[model samples]
Target: MILKTYRWSFVVTAVGLVLAAWYGLSAHLGIGQAIALVLILSILEISLSFDNAVVNATILERMSDFWRKIFLSVGIIVAVFGMRLIFPIVLVCVTAGLSPAEVIRLALAGGDPETPGTYGYELHEAHPTIAAFGGMFLLMLFLNFIFGEKEHHWIGPLERLLEKVGKLEYVQVIVAGAVLLIVAESFATEHGRTVLASGLAGIVTYLLVNGLGELFNVEEHLEHGEHHEEGAPARSNGPTPVARATGKAAFFLFLYLEVLDASFSFDGVIGAFAITSDPVIIAIGLGVGAMYIRSMTVHLVEEGTLAQYPYLENGALWAIGALAAILLISIEIEIPEVVTGLIGLAFIVASLISSIRYNRAHPEEAHAETAAAHS
Candidate 1:
């Protein structure tokens, strides 16, 4: 079962390690050294992105089979080439006011991040804006999940308060805006305008992508007349079959996933520089890690793990909220990547423990959940 689920991830890990070895030998680094560095970074990426897999599975399970195939194909391409390699180069071009060709040339020159007027240097200089955009977007997503309608609560007291606040008009938006305003004025005083603008862009991107996805989903659902009975009145409160979306609605959901991936990539892309300035090695290591995350997402969906552990998604969202705060705070604090990953992992572990206890206490409910998932 594990092999069937993670075949591609294993293949990519092997290929990535081989390429890393080749690159290391060519650079005069021993094969062993090269493979070791790649292995270390790959582990780092997996640890950092494990929470991402859980969050991704929440959406991936709702997509149709064809769309899942598209996710494996097109999604991998974007995750590897787009965010891992090309995005950093493009970011340098924009931040350094250089042409794409110039940026590529700089990168080819072995742009050590410590050196000014180089690819890595330019990219690092753009970190503030990157953090602001990614942080706000993730914050919005976390807020939406916790605040939106839900029968389950991972942390009853806190989640209940958020849910009640969610019933108020645009509370998430208001809170997000307030956060942006405060951060822009206080911590990012020098680049306040840029920080605010980037944060606003993040918020707008979330609103546009999530709103459109939900809108198209409603349209697709109504068009199918999914719950309407023959010669019978339509029911307004029928079960929502959001998990069966396809066509344009599914396309939008796929787009949302890509954006979320991009936001999560910021830390990984930048943090890799702390180890090595070689973009190729970073791409190979992180790309392999991305495959593992994708595979984990598929495994979770196929195993019906979320159905069994109802609090898992809530935990992932809480972790996301923590990450968003860490990203924003790191604009001035320089928090370590490992620290970020550990914080998220702590939340996930707590939630898993909570879920197991819930299941033990409510055996009947757990059995009902298992039956529904299988059905």
Candidate 2:
């Protein structure tokens, strides 16, 4: 049932591309080149975005069905338009004197005829900064996965202490918002400001769009309380679990996904600057990538694939988490985006194929079957 629905999404995605080619290609590019561009970009985007789905699935799988649907719909909007579109504009205003339109125009020019301040990194022309950005981003992402805490503690000492404070909710928001502002303020130089601005923009956009989704009952997704395991059987129709739950868990989940996506994108986006500075191409490539990732995420959730391949999912999550940190480092170092994407993809695909083969060999191995489950 889950896989069937996802099949249609894939079809729709394909058909949509066909329609885009039929109409939009002639205006923007020649037919053959346009088709090739679309295919190449799509493949690159999908490959880069594969880990994003695993990370997102880890959270989306835990949500109530209602919220899961919103994640499929509204979340796509945020990722495609908010992150891929508005984000570059934010980067432009702070880093270059160019307005978003001018930046986009420069990108469309494609560095063919020499023009000053057009469509590329004047800074990245120097090899060291590129290396510094790429290396640092990768290092941070890798360290966070190895060192960062994974579990949530509801009645933990920290929560208990926070409980003592009146208006805890507002305090949390204010603190997060303040941290974002401080980070944004500190990046005064062109390169630093571009990174800080783009990062903060992703954080804020996630909060606003995701927050509104919860507020409006766009879907019934809710965070599981400390007591419940995600797949535990429940009474089906009694007030629906999501309606009874608070929105904080859902909000935080979205926040984490957004930050993860932004971090993972740092390398690719920066790398694209190497290809062409055309904010338009950046938007198109990243926007298309974001859409496919959303589709992949929803497909994973509906198919219950993650539930069946826990270790594989875990590995992919860590891979993406590591990739995000690497992206931050890449802002300072010059780790190749191609290497990062290829290595990460290899891990995920190998794990996925292994999981599939294992399941096939032991047909009943799924869903914690009998003692025969032993290796």
Best by TM-score: 1
TM-score of 1: 0.94
Cand. 1 Cα-lDDT: 0.85
Q: For each candidate, what TM-score against the reference?
A: 0.94, 0.62
* Model 1 spans with C-alpha error above 4 angstroms: 227-243
Which 10-residue span in candidate 1 carries the lowest summed lDDT? 233-242
RMSD of 1: 3.3
Candidate 2 residue-wise lDDT at 130: 28
Cα lDDT, model 2, residue 20:
44
Q: Which prediction has the highest lDDT against the true structure?
A: 1
Computed on alpha carbons, the lDDT of every model, listed in order, comes to 0.85, 0.53
lDDT of 1 by residue, 244-300 (tens): 679988899899999999988889988988887778888888898888888898888
